[model samples]
Each structure stands twice: as structure tokens, then as C-alpha cells.
Target: MTTLPRSYWCHRDFDGPGRGRLELQSMTTPYPGRAVTWMRESVRDALTGLDRPTFGIAWAWLGNHQASGAAIRELRQGRPYTFTLPAPDGHWTWSAHPVSVLPVIETCANAPSSRQQLVPAHANGDPP
Candidate 1:
């Protein structure tokens, strides 16, 4: 498990053209855990350069039994997760949260770390 300060900037990506689309910065130690996810549109746009929605939440990391998951906010469909942005000292400040953590967490649970995010930096090695 990762460690967090009592308060830190939190960012969660919303899945649509609303409050959930832009990056958010907030502070949350959490009563339990937070839901974070990538919008199907954002990642799809980023990956294909076509600007479309490609995926949805599948699963997430809670403790063992362990399916003890909660929404980032009540009634919110956001996918909760844990991971902070990196600070200057190589520390991840708790900013830039995802809209859902489900797919990433489940992916991590099975795949090797190096194989994750299996795609070229750019289809042709240029910035998106």
C-alpha cells in the first residue's frame, strides 16, 4: 500500500464533458478510500488521436475479502484508487486523482509492472 500525508492535493479525472473531465486538485486522507478513473473519452482520444470513448471501469483495489469498496462520493460512478503524483523529491503528492481506480487496480493485480501501460509513447514518438 502507498502512504499519504494528513492532507495533500487530490486529482480525479471525470469520464465526460463535465466536472469529471478536467483534472481536479484537492486534499483527502479519506474516511476509507477514494474512487478515481480515466474517462473512456480522454484515454481513447489520447491513444488513437480520434477523440472518443474506449473503455469503462472493471474492478478496483480494496483490501482482501476485501471487496470492501466505496464510491469516491455517494452515488458517484467514479472509480476509486490510490496513487499520488510525484513531487520534486520523487515523492508522489496526492494530486491528480483518477475518476476510477477499478481497471488499473485489477490490471496491476495480474500483470507484471513493466508490461503495464503497454503502448508506445507516441504512435510515431511525438507528444500527444
Candidate 2:
């Protein structure tokens, strides 16, 4: 099993509509309060190609479950697409540089609208 960094949790899409997507959400330090979801196969491949451990460092964020009022951007201005979440205050409480790019993965095209309500985190069968 891959050991996750401190405060970083790996989320598997499993049987959900976003099956192929890999996400990592962190709760402290680095880009705290950022949730990054990689969507494009090309970008995911590139990051994976760079190095598992190294790429793992750049892999995910602590996304705002609401999916609105976020900004989207690219890692290098190319084909790799990602989904990033920013804090409610929009400040990088942990780092001087805030990663504010809210990338839209390929699967996001078929995703429900941002206004759609999502299942509460507590309802995923995990104890709150």
C-alpha cells in the first residue's frame, strides 16, 4: 500500500461516476485547504512519469466540496488538466505561494453542475 504524507488522504473514485480519477486532499501545510483532482490522462501520465513520489507531492489538494468560486489553471499551460480547491478565505495559510488553479479534468465535462448538491462527506459510510 502507498503511504500517504502527513495530513494527505488519497481518495479513490471506485464505483462512482468518476471511476478513473485519482485525488489527494490535504488538511495542513504546503497548499493547505487545496483539493486537487487530476482529470486528463495526459496530465496524470505526465505527473506519474515525472516520478511517483515527486508527482505525489503535486498530486492533490483540499478542495471546497461546493465546487464554485474557484479558479482554474494549468501546470505548464498545456494539455494536463486538474481540479484544485481553494480555502474559503482564498489565502494560502500555509505557504507564501498559493496554488489557485482549479483544473477541470476530462471527466468533468460529464460531471453534474456546480450548483448540484453533493452527498455529505459523513454519508460515505465513514463515521464522522
lDDT of 2 by residue, 1-128 (tens): 65333222212122324334535322222222332332222234445334444354435432233321232232222222234323222211111123334334688658788642566656877675
lDDT of each structure?
A: 0.33, 0.33
Error of 1 at 119 (Å): 61
TM-score of 1: 0.20
Q: TM-score for candidate 2, please give it.
A: 0.19
Candidate 1, residues 21-122: lDDT per residue as tens digits? 445545433333432232212222333322222212111221222332333442133334443222222222222233322222445568676753676667
Stretches > 4 Å off in candidate 2: 1-41, 61-69, 73-128
Please give the clash total of every predicted structure, in order: 20, 9
Judge candidate 2 at residue 42 and give its lDDT. 25
